[model samples]
Target chain A: MGVFGHKTVSMTAKIRLYVDHPLGDGQTVPLDRDQAHYLFGVMRQQEGADVALFNGRDGEWLAQVTQAGKRGGELTCVRQTRPLQMPPDLWLLFAPIKKARTDFIVEKAAEMGAAKIIPVQTEYTNSERIRQDRLQAHAVEAAEQCGGTYVPEVTDLQRLDRLLADWPSTRRLMFCDEAEAGAARALGAAPRGPWAILIGPEGGFSVTERAKLHGLPFAHVVSLGPRILRADTAAVAALTVWQQALGDWDGPQSD
Target chain B: MGVFGHKTVSMTAKIRLYVDHPLGDGQTVPLDRDQAHYLFGVMRQQEGADVALFNGRDGEWLAQVTQAGKRGGELTCVRQTRPLQMPPDLWLLFAPIKKARTDFIVEKAAEMGAAKIIPVQTEYTNSERIRQDRLQAHAVEAAEQCGGTYVPEVTDLQRLDRLLADWPSTRRLMFCDEAEAGAARALGAAPRGPWAILIGPEGGFSVTERAKLHGLPFAHVVSLGPRILRADTAAVAALTVWQQALGDWDGPQSD
Candidate 1:
């Protein structure tokens, strides 16, 4: 069976669905009304059509639609297609900007292999609140679209100072300092176990916040380049830089 | 004067506007109706207020609003702020996706320092037409927001094959091959000078197109990572990788 290979499996089963239920051989998975409408009404996937399923825990499984209804549906797992390819132990900590841009950040983070996504509230951060559930949904959708077995968790908004005070010593922080813009401090030589990329808000980190971050032992201040990128662009750029330098981009899984 | 430095000049004059008129000491720049509305009606900028201005050719200039009105306004250039900082000789060739995502690709290309942006119509490209003017405006907005002196040109849609057939031999192409996903072909050793990053559409390129690109001697086929990325995410990631490896990210301007 070509089910063991990700590319081959996805080619055969075009639609990938993320479910909360477990996946295994011959396991029957139930789909909600929305999923039913999407498969039966939208995508028009009928009974006997193949669909890939993943639940963030189990490996991806090839499933065949057993019952397609207007309000609900069911699928029976054929076999494990691809093993759970966990993303690198990387987290993205970014200050939320506008509503749409914030969603873009989360979606990109998920597609780019971020293990966890946290929205931080710095002094210069404009948005005081974020819909964590909504962001998580975006992450899920991104994973579904990007052919990822794992979906990164999107945590609620947290105070930057509070999060840093109890920061894990072993987990390094890649601080994209705008003040140090155009600096040549790339992550090329940075040690890479349990890392997080911190992106500032539009106004950037306050002087006090910058001072605190600079003084932190685990903080590795770096610059994305000469230009002052908006918070959303910075998030994507930082994630890419970190991924290429220390994340899974060039890891053992990569050829 | 701190005006010559990008950081210092932007700090003093918060608003950065892109003007088509030439900028020099004691010269006056006429703002259009929309600009006047933004400066006076939206931002509430009054006469005597300082604003930073930049033309694509000229360097950034510090100007003071001399005349403020609803229909139009004028600003007198005080002095040259930051000198013209051109981006790397990079052209981003991408198959246009959705309207919003196409806009996103242009904005990010400008922010990430692409000298030119081209939307190529691949065999699988969905969008048949793109508003070059609207995309150009997005590039301008991105440059203004990112504090970039140069704005990349957004060219009209062109056929990918036609563009490739007349490809400049000196300009190497970084073809982001989704088919080669997980391949560890990092661009660390790729030659600099006049490079372009080619990103496929959501449906990806045709088999023949991929074969043709791989056969091209000037093309550097590379993979972003194991999992597939959306065209927009891939664009930003490819730009970041190329910038770090061979672009202006670590040149004389960097510390």
Candidate 2:
């Protein structure tokens, strides 16, 4: 393995897998039936193939397929390729929209480095509940595709009022308010230790909800632009804005 | 009409429609078969219903439905609600990805105020051609949904090399390079004139293509972040970064 071992592993491995097991040198990781089918049935990987693995805690590891079978498979870690790079302590709190768009939001949030994803139910939110497991799987797949080691947890849907009732005092909320369109308020001046971005639904926040959020000391209401963006587009744009202004985009890679 | 006349029209009209004809005072606009079906059959809009209309030229108009039928309809403009709010002189040049994701990019680009959209084919670009008409329709739909008065033109697929060969010298290019991940370079200092953002395909630009981009005088290579973003996510993020830095996000609504 060269220098940081990233070059060697990246050159040898074409597929990145996320697992729940620990990653270290000479550790054997058994693949479940679904993973076996994906490796053997879909991807056609056989024994002795190099696979990159990450378990969200121990960084990334280079593993070799030792026992490949139709029903199950096993891989032994050869070396550590990368260390875990934790994202900024940023949470994305948004009113869930439609199914595909909600999934898109979760996946983009994971790729854009939102440490936690929470689905909030506002008065105008169209979605009653979200499939947390499915959203979590999307987050994992997004991390796998985007070469991310950490997967943001997708929490179950909670009421917006309730979430704000016991809001953490230390965390600042960047609320993307549609009513604030054309306003020049940005997140550039906001202090950025811990932040959460709140995006409303398609119909936007109710008048009372907006008043409550505006009254909160931690909420920094900002406009996305002149146009009123859809809930999903607003989520991605909010995350991008937060990442650029207050997240890790300004510094070198910590890992 | 209450200052901008936006409040009265928006409060009375629940549906916004994009038309091809010019919109002005007392102007009668005819609707096509598809539009008529959408208004009558799908949305159940009846005669005398108020519908907001924008034709990409004249500002927005509050129109009252005069004839509503299954195959055709007509609307008479009552008054101009808002002026034609033009986006900044910015274009989005991106290599097309999957179909749905490509649609998503165009939609978000329109919502984020890209003046034009161009699909470029790079060395590693997977798509050979894109349906320009379909993408244009998606832009129109996005504008309609996002309450935008302007719709960005979706150009047909063009080769990256040829486009760069005759690239306009006045328009600056924000090149998002995957290899430059974790770089601290940003668009904060860039000027606010004519500009464009270039996003590579999933496989990214080949070495030769990247070198060529880096060699261009107008190109400014920038990194999205540490984690690699997909083409769609990169497009939105790049737009957000550019808008926040040098686009219309900081200014008041300009009509």
Candidate 3:
């Protein structure tokens, strides 16, 4: 929890912050054990030191530590630094891969403007064990690194069959079907509605999975390219393709 | 060498081969020490045993072990098995990243259908040290894993300036500009040509680098999406976009 627990704050390129709430009349905000360790032990924030703070919905604000300790720390929230970060409306749905590659996928997914990251287990998937906390933590860090206001939600891994069984009516699924030849131009040209890009696993979607996906009226079986791509590569590729084709551009689009 | 040295052959399905050639064919196709060790010690093939061989351009052939030792190993090329695996004609050009990510980039690049993998040193590139041979081996292994006939050649790290200075006349540079808003259609609508997808490193292109690249007549600045992609992600994303766009799309057309 050392570096991982650093509070996401809003500050200028170079600015100090205090965390005592202005509404609370300079009363120091209590730092949890994990947060205290991170600030004092890891980040080495001392008393009267400045740091940034931001609630997900609220604009970023500066804070300063009034008390420092190994196990306990306190800070005071001060003036505002910057406005809250607004994220794009992109959702990424990908078949899960191995643990390490899966983590990598989740991390990149969050950093890449995905409002939601959904994991679908396809027919060919072998490994099923997943630590949701680990994946969610990776997403949080990735969001912070990219300076995004919204952290993409890491939904539990669900079977493709079940997820598609009750597929949403409003959200269009840009199914990245490698088996689908070069019919992408036609499908891509007419894309509409809220979109999510679906990438298969390394072994690729089973014939049944592909067919199930094909039957969906909302599904756009988009192709990644001429050559076969690894599942993780396909995920990133599909996201890029979908973003260009229908994702929010220049931050948030009119949609 | 243990797992990678075995020349994995891909048939439409499983193949049964016969090895019959003059024991000594006066071929200087020397097996490296590693290959010899794997063939003689690891594989434990006898003096007369059937093995498969394919040299990308050359048709697949059956080869029999005539000599077996760690220092020297020889096999006589016999009857043909099947035609060689012809890979798609696509090249991947990416600026170097940290070592692990760079290796990941090369491995995934080969597995994903890159005919050639070139690592370029960009203006913001922090990695100056690269082992060409080691990286090349990674490409070979990736090809083997994906059952690809053509092992992409991982060229020595070339300066971006030097590479553009002598850019190929016929090859279309599909520049994957991260700052680009988005591709018209990721890969789907990418213009056709002898294509190369260029991915910049983490810190991104310097002003000078960007200007030089933009000035190139053959460069087509395309986007992956709205997000700020990492270097490795950008490489795969760019390649995917290229594959979708001008690649071998034999799908049903809109018309």
Candidate 4:
């Protein structure tokens, strides 16, 4: 595009951007105001600077910045560095707790390679309504920071009953139950399929909800151990356990 | 000790406290100003109410409040509830990052079952010094919050070289290196023994440091995965991975 072609320096920039626009070879990706400010004003990128772009569809592309301005910038794709590596079809379904912890859950979920993030309203869920846009932004930020090509979608908050009613029989649910503490089974032995990890809120699931979940055929009730983990900690632990056991942690590409 | 015997009602109190004093049958534990304010003023607890107490040595004990005051208070120990279940001999050695992230690391490590927490100074370590006392307090608070009977000690910051020089031959180190990012081997096949998960700083381990670590016979280098995790996220992920692999995650008591 300018001083050096993307093929010449394929592995130069560490800054990876997650864009919504389509990407391909020779395609010029336009930057929004925020991304322009970040690239030009904050990171102080100049013309011909190398940048990596991923649109969650195509593989990561090494792009050369052709124009740099405070209000607008453009980077033309040159070469694909990596294929679109999707995370395992794992879903993180958690009851929203405090605001910061909720943000943390979404961010960590993205980093740990959850395919989708869903907020469910349990009886004990503290937050009645969630800002889906804010959480989705956090997920995008996490993906960008973690160098992940895939960005998990943050679904709007739904009632726990509705979610269970519409639960896919093929998708197994790993129900994190606090009442059944210390009664957890080894996740390593769990059957591999579409899986979702359900973490409860601070006050935990109500008795009626627990009963309904216990009766659900698709729900595989498991405990996080003897310690009383907060909802956020439980989310991370559950994801880690699930990933290590059945997710992409042990996949060939990971190694 | 006052109105109710230790065996009177073991399930009455949900409040748990981490006291600095020894606890035993009929032993009166003194509460400081802060504890007094929290119990009496904040929680509105009255004399003769039951409280659970753990001092990191004895098992958790059910204690009864005997004296109520604005400045000071006392509780008489009744009986032990849960034994002092120690975490595995797994230590978390990490280069300190930002203050809040470091705190998050300590808290998560405790909640996730780390035996010892050590902050090491590496070549690319950003924080030159760490508040050992504050971090240790965080460990305690995490244990308390997670209902852990045993608390992991947060050791003072030690140079990585010095620590490696005096490394115990019995302990195996799971070195998390960014250079070997996608080339990480599975931790499942790692030999079980005294173990420590060493996470580098924000800038990652320097070349010389990585070389030394790779050359060590006791070090088993592993990667977190393809995704680039932050230092704090890496610590939690490493601990979770190790725990799910060789720690007490699959132990009989955990279930």
Candidate 5:
């Protein structure tokens, strides 16, 4: 159905929308006030306008704007356009740094195809507490902006020791170490399975933390070049390296 | 020799410096007012304080503060520390986006080891003009912060057609195409040679521009992943893929 009182018509242009509600043919998806403002007020989308919707569950779907209002709106599902293409089972674990840098890490992690985002508190971690909900919102925004159907879950702050205690033996960990500065280990050689990339804080890992990580059989320490990258950059670089090396970047179903 | 009036001392911490002046053993480097303030007022480094310095042409050097002043200062080279490690013979050509994002492209390019940075103007490019000097300064700052000895030159904005008209056949171009959303080409398979990564503006490339790029014999089109990354994130992701695939990230001398 065409918006603005026009007849129903097919559209090719993709206007991606990430909805928290379920999606299926003929299902009505409600939008919050902000989303309504964005769709109706900012983007000027009108009722009956075709919109792509993903609920991080049902794949991507073509939908029609059923009700457009200033305070709220609704989108009725039409048909599936693309399957729910989930990112690889790769997780990103890092120590929270400054507020902006931490947000940058989360945003980049979401954009770079991290399946999960975990903030770890280490001995040398500077930030004592993190606004987990805010960071998760940034991830959602990033996923929404990146045209990603799947949104990585950003978990609340967890202690490194506690998390490592239950570390999955089958999942290999790419430990980015500062001490191994010049050792540009080719991460491609590592076998791919469940994996996680662990990046430390700006001050780097403490001696005890380093020893524990090094002692882990699942940890494969890797260096991100010789230069010391800031925490945020390291997160992006590490994610890129991991994705290129063993993640879904080489797969045919990337898009 | 060490700073703060110390005798010959052993220092393990690497404090990188980027000076406009040439650097060599016994050579003197004069600091500007800002640098003087950073060293004296901020860092509180007094006379005889050891500092590492690098010019784009020269290798890194260990130097000791010779003249300490409020407005200006000087450091005399004591010994050669590390050789000038040049990044791969790779260039990054990207359309200028928002101010902060453009700055980010330059900063991450320098950190990820782009040998040259070029801003190209395309039909869909939003920014009418770019501050080349400011972007260049950001590159220099990135190099300094990342402890890189070489700083990539940031060229002024140029027409993409003109650049392609004088294209070097030996240099392979990795054109990041938005249309190839799902075809994640394996960049690792491409032969190593003079290379450049071309990232388009936020609006993406015009059809004519894509046709020109696709028609190039030297162009190797690649996809970052399934997600539609913003221009800035795409730049960093593309650079990481290139570096991990064929750039110096495989070499031992990443630092």
Candidate 6:
């Protein structure tokens, strides 16, 4: 989303709905039961009403409702009114925390412009199970709340060891290693590259995990400074540091 | 707070302790009931036990328990062990949140190397009452948890409007103004001086509050970036942004 707000004359609010359809003008998009119930029953959106829609690729568009049924709804894409606000080229990876904290991590990550969010299971991680859909919804809601046109895709929970198994060749990993002793490396000079920041759980990465990460060729071991931050704090801290250093946080971001 | 853990030490078992008393060699420091209970009851420190004491001044020192009691304790300051770890000149000025979050702010600030933590009352802020002692204890515990040698002083709650009135002449205020929108002003490029990072509350700083802040000549209006950050995340984000930009996160600290 651009920093400047744009005014749209949305009335009888089309209830900005998301459908699993290739968005285009005159293309009819089927609303899933959940979205239908939300728009028709919950929002009381009537047939022939106008609503906004957007996919990650399609810019925001105003759609006209074609059908409103008891259990379903359908709309035809009208026109793209706003360009998709591409998220920052940053990935947020972290061990899953307790329920609320995990949700908080996703919410903050989405609000902070993370292009993708990954939940990793570490050696000392207490929670391996993740509510991926719930987290994904949280991210969507965060984007909506922040007036962002882009929503970060939340990946299914994966083991840290496995994700590092055949690591992507191009993406660089910015390991937020808290137990830096006190290296005090400057974030000012962080190298520019495709970057992902990994935050450990509350107990922190086990020695074995840290050793594996430290030895990786593509990993850049960095400190969020000297503190033994809680896992969530480390996530936000690492994101901020990375954004200030390498992410599209400074200077003009190219759309 | 040295840049590296390179200044070698003849390794010894170290336990960072908090004493309300000002520390000095040959001075018999008496632990209050709380400290005594924490030392003897919780930590199981016995008479003649060795421990380290730091009072935000006087380098860390070896201390031996002279008397042990459930309600009271006494210790004799021994030789100075590690030199005082002076925190970077950073002040955390934040709008007070709910009880737990407010405590969280003070605790994280202390651990993250803040020299002082100030709680300010904002217009949209609902809570005016604060438990200064409890908040102070949280800071102490965070310092202990993070192995910090300095415990930031937690000042009593003051009105936000009032504190900004006498905005220090020498200190530069990095206002984490959400109003900066998507303007990517690299905080790293901003002038670094005696600094403080300001974070607003849940409802955010009021319009009048923002205008007053923007009007200040010494204030540097900077965005933590796109997406609306919750107050707590905003606090950590602002701090990390500062440490990466200006604070001691990367600079050399000499003994």
Q: Largest lDDT belongs to which candidate?
A: 1
The TM-score values for the models, in the order shown, are 0.93, 0.94, 0.77, 0.90, 0.89, 0.77
- The digit string of per-residue lDDT tens for model 5 on B17-110 reads 7899988868989999999998889998999888888898888788999999999999999988778888899999998988887998899899
Model 4 clash tally, residue pairs: 1
Clash counts per candidate, in order, are 1, 0, 20, 1, 7, 2
| Evaluation by lDDT, superior candidate among 3 and 5 | 5
- In angstroms, the error of model 5 at B210 is 1.5
DockQ preference between candidates 5 and 6, better one: 5
lDDT of each: 0.84, 0.83, 0.65, 0.80, 0.80, 0.74
Q: Sort the candidates on DockQ, descending order.
A: 1, 2, 5, 4, 3, 6
What is the C-alpha lDDT profile of model 6 across A109-199, one tens digit per residue?
9877889999988876777688899999998877655556688999999888989996888788888765563343454475676778888
**Model 5 spans > 4 angstroms off:** A1-15, A178-186, A252-255, B1-15, B178-186, B252-255
> Could you tell me the lDDT of residue A205 within candidate 3?
61
Tens digits of per-residue lDDT, candidate 2, A1-255, equal 111101111445778899999888899999999999999899999999998899999998889999999999999999988889888999999877778888999998998899999999988776797889999999999888777889999999999999999998999999886556644335677786888998877666667988898999998888777766777777888888787777888663232
What's the CA RMSD for each of the models? 3.5, 3.8, 6.5, 5.3, 5.4, 5.6
lDDT of 1 by residue, B4-26 (tens): 11122235687889999999989
Q: What tens digits encode model 5's per-residue C-alpha lDDT throughout A1-255?
A: 111000011334346778899898799999999999999998999988988888788887889999999999999998987788788889999988878778988999988888899999988777889998999999988866666678899999999999999998888999987446534446768887789999887666767888899999999887776555777777887887777667777663332
Please state the Cα-based DockQ of model 1 relative to the true two-chain complex: 0.40
DockQ top scorer: 1
Assess the local accuracy of residue A126 in candidate 5 as a C-alpha lDDT between 0 and 100.
Answer: 72
Model 6's CAPRI class? Answer: incorrect
Clashing pairs in 6: A14-A51, B59-B84
